[model samples]
Target: MGSTVNMQKQTDKVNLFETQMTMPPTSEKGSSGNVPEDDPSFNPFGFVTDNPSSRSAIQLPETPAEDGNVGQMLYRTEDKGREFGSTIKSGKLRWFVRETGSKESRRGTVVFLHGAPTQSFSYRTVMSEMSEFGFHCYAPDWIGFGFSDKPQPGYGFNYTEKEYHEAFDKLLDTLEINSPFFLVVQGFLVGTYGLTWALKNPSKIEKIAILNTPLTVSSPVPGLFKQLRIPLFGEFTCQNAILAERFIEGGSPYVLKNEKADVYRLPYLSSGGPGFALLETAKKINFGDTLGQIANGFSSGSWDKPTLLAWGIADKYLSQSIAEEFEKQNPQNVKLQLIEGAGHLPQEDWPEKVVAALRSFF
Candidate 1:
């Protein structure tokens, strides 16, 4: 918690109504043929032809700096209040920030890390709700899966636990944010980024919330994940276009809504998509080691921070036993909360339950 602050000054606002009167129409509907030379619409002002020799001024919008550092562009939402920012110092890393309410009304900040095949857009609906709850939410789109820059082959798409930890530190520093808040993680990202943040800055973290996330490999991984971990086959499969199509088809069952399957698959359709990143993640991050460290930390009874587990009962990739095992191992540190009628993407399936659980924990 911190002191309340007022809203900052409003930025640029373009007037489309005023500009339309001076601008000439470029084309008309159902006009298939080229315009006649004498037509008024044809080079009416001769601006395009006259400006051919003059270099047009490229107008780049000004992005607000935090701590004197300018954030790279990833994407922007319709509302303009939410924007995605990325950085590529050592590697590609992206984050989504919704700077809507006044600083004084910001109850807390929640940093969300998305899983594979999904980006910050996946949390758009949830972010709206959280923002109303007085939280300045930040959700990062891990490299290779969003508007963030995609690294070429042999350049690694996966983020190691240590790398994510450092990126989070830089993100916070650049944002000039220093406050106790909650960490919300999902899917494989939970292991890479979430666990790293929890371990590195336990004192700063106020609470931990996980949904359908696997911290440990309690059961054998699904064949898809296992296949992605294989050496040559993994690389070949990840880079193959057909495999991405197949993955999209297979992943439909794990999402809450049917339409979401396509949304989740959008990133993989591009070259070097989520499949490539997934393969890299398996190669770089030591899943077993991370899970073991988490288990050890929780079992040692040293962590006093409140932990909440909200797992989708229908999760195809992860099982219920994993949650039970985590609870059994760290009964004193965790509060197991079940989410029914949800699959791998519980936040999409059960946003209410997820928010309710976080409220209780925080």
Candidate 2:
């Protein structure tokens, strides 16, 4: 209760959108490559580009594909608003939730938390496959990312570490998404945030699996992520469809298929772009301080829960030594698995291997 109140007070401390970020000056400047910006169906807020010259951004599909993939579903007002009424009632966000597997044949529930700039769409294939193995999987696009509500600055969303953790906790409570579920956390801030939450609510978590997320600052920030935190350049890259596409491609050792890449792009481009949300989220990342807190949280407490550190050897952003040392320190219950030929987004690059790792862990 104290934490909840503290988080609320923190939210009141800042004006999220005081920094002025304007849309590209002209329709030609607005388009991301060959993707038409002036189309009648175009949503300026949907996909974006910082590249003033039409040469740089990737050309995204004019419209989303019609065929529905497995576990693809939108959050209707009645279904998602049941417990967390305020989030839905605000009308600023209609969060997306993806699920696979049935309770009847469920082995266990696995909650997947994606990192910044990416939603649950990152785990679509992984979740569907895990369902075949008898595990019920759930992945939600965190408030700002994915199809969730992207509240601009003046509205209430602060996009802080505390805010995200609180929002996720409230979502679980409101939905009655009980514990005894495995938590798979991706990226740095998210990994730390989820770890802290699991430590406090140990009863709910079955195990913890971390992928390409550094728990300390010894690892340098990747160039792409670093750019996201820079002022004008960061904002430009964050909203640019080409840069985003390149980041995704570079993060993985495997080539991403066209359709899958589009899925990742749609959310950021949705509604004239979630640039404000992206910038707010990037500003919260303080590796030196935050990583220390996470390391302390893991070290000071007795983490008897099983933890798996799956590192991608080819990852340019996160260091492999950190993962090695983490497992070295906790040999009793922690296991470090190096995923070869995989980069940051292992789920996308090597879903088969990722699935195998989960199955073995369970």
Candidate 2, residue 90: how far the Cα is off, in Å: 9.9
Q: Write the residue-wise lDDT of candidate 2 on 191-304 in tens digits.
A: 566666776777888888888877765766667667778778877777665454456655654334344445555555444356557777777767788776656555524677
Q: Least lDDT summed over 10 consecutive residues: which range in candidate 2?
A: 11-20
* Stretches of model 1 off by over 4 angstroms after superposition: 1-102, 153-158, 189-191, 217-219, 240-259
Q: Cα RMSDs of all predictions?
A: 14.5, 13.5
Cα-based TM-score, every candidate: 0.67, 0.72
Score candidate 1 by TM-score against the native: 0.67
What range of 10 consecutive residues in model 1 has the weakest lDDT sum?
A: 64-73
lDDT string for model 1 (141-235, tens) is: 66555555556536643456666577667766766658877787876643346766677688878888877666665544556667778888888
Relative to the true structure, how large is the alpha-carbon lDDT of every model?
Answer: 0.56, 0.62
- With candidate 1 superimposed using the best TM-score fit, by how many Å does residue 333's alpha carbon deviate from the native? 2.3
lDDT of prediction 2: 0.62
Per-model clash counts, in order, read 2, 11
